[model samples]
Target: MKVRVGFGYDVHALVPERDLWLGGVKIEHTMGLQGHSDADVLIHAICDALLGAANMRDIGYHFPDTAGEYKDIDSKILLFDTMELLRDAGYTLGNIDATVAAERPKLNPHIPEMKRVMADVLQVDVEDISIKATTTEKLGFTGRQEGIAAYATVLIQK
Candidate 1:
């Protein structure tokens, strides 16, 4: 089997009134991420990682923000489509490990649900998807709660 590894990172500004979507589930928060889509930072990162591992280019290339069809679209749909692209290219996901950086709203409590949702979208075992969160030690944009960011690394095989 041929195995490949890839890494991805993404960030979105937080703003009031918008719904906070992470991984593939909604989290109650005073602020939500700003983006053309639902702005699921974790999912975007995972998508990029998977695509990169397959040497298929990045997420924005495949799913452009300029497209009207994607406006405020569900990120889970994008994740599902990304998997289809990978499968069509003769690649299968092995596992994913990801981390979200945030300052407030306590991400730990939501991790299990995030993992479940992401696993379902990727059609992988829940154990194959690992979601971790950190506070950034109150040291950066994430620490100040200006935005949220996520990093993901994935392994894929053919």
Candidate 2:
């Protein structure tokens, strides 16, 4: 079997009056991530990781932010579409490990749901996906509560 690895990172500004969507689930927060899509930073990172592993380009390359079709679009749809692209490229998911950095709303409590939702969307075992959270100890934009950021690493095989 041929195995490959890829990494992805994403960040979004936080603002009032929008829901905070991360890792495919909404979390209660004073500020939500701002972007053309739902701004699920974790999902976007994972999509990029998978696409990279398959050498199929990144998420924005497949789904352009300039296109109106992605405006306020549910990120889960993009995740599903990304998986299809990988499958078409003859790549199968091996595993994923991801981390979300946020200073508030307590991402740890929501990690289980995030893993479940992503596993379902990718049609993979939940055990194959790992989600982790950190606070950055109040250091950067995420630590200062100005935004949320996520990083993902994935392994794929053919």
Candidate 3:
């Protein structure tokens, strides 16, 4: 068996009049992350991590923001597509650990749902995916509530 590891990071600015999406679950918040897609930073990071582990290109290489088809697209679709890419390459997921950083709306309460939702999309057991949420201690953009960020690490094997 061949095993590989990959890591991914993503950030999006918070903006009004948008829904906050993370790990395929929507959270009620005053502001949402802005992006060409639904701006689910957690899913994007996980997609990148999976692609990197498979030695495939990043998410943007597969799903370009320049494409109108992706405008306001659901990040869960992107995760499903990413999984398909890995499946095509004969790579199966071993595990995933992801973290989200934010200063408001308190993400911990929503983590379980996020894990279940993302695991369903990835076609893995909920145990195979771990999601964590934290505050940046009022230091940076996330700390200042200007944006949200996510990081993900994945293991894949063939």
Off by over 4 Å in 2: none
lDDT per residue as tens, model 3, 32-113? 8899999999999999999999989899999999999999999999999999999999999999999999999798889899
Q: How close is candidate 3 to the true structure, as a TM-score?
A: 0.99
Error of 2 at 153 (Å): 0.2
Q: Scored by Cα lDDT, where does model 3 land?
A: 0.94
Cα lDDT for residue 34, candidate 1: 99
Question: Per-residue lDDT for 15-72 in model 2, tens only?
Answer: 9999999989988888899999999999999999998888888999999999999999
Model 3 residue 138 distance off true place after TM-score fit, in angstroms: 0.2
Cα error, residue 65 of model 3, in Å, equals: 0.1
Candidate 3: Cα lDDT at 154: 98
Worst 10 residues of 1 by lDDT: 115-124
Report the CA-based lDDT of candidate 2 relative to the real structure.
0.93
* Model 1 ranges off by over 4 Å: none
**Candidate 1 lDDT (Cα, whole model)?**
0.94
Stretches off by above 4 angstroms in model 3 are: none
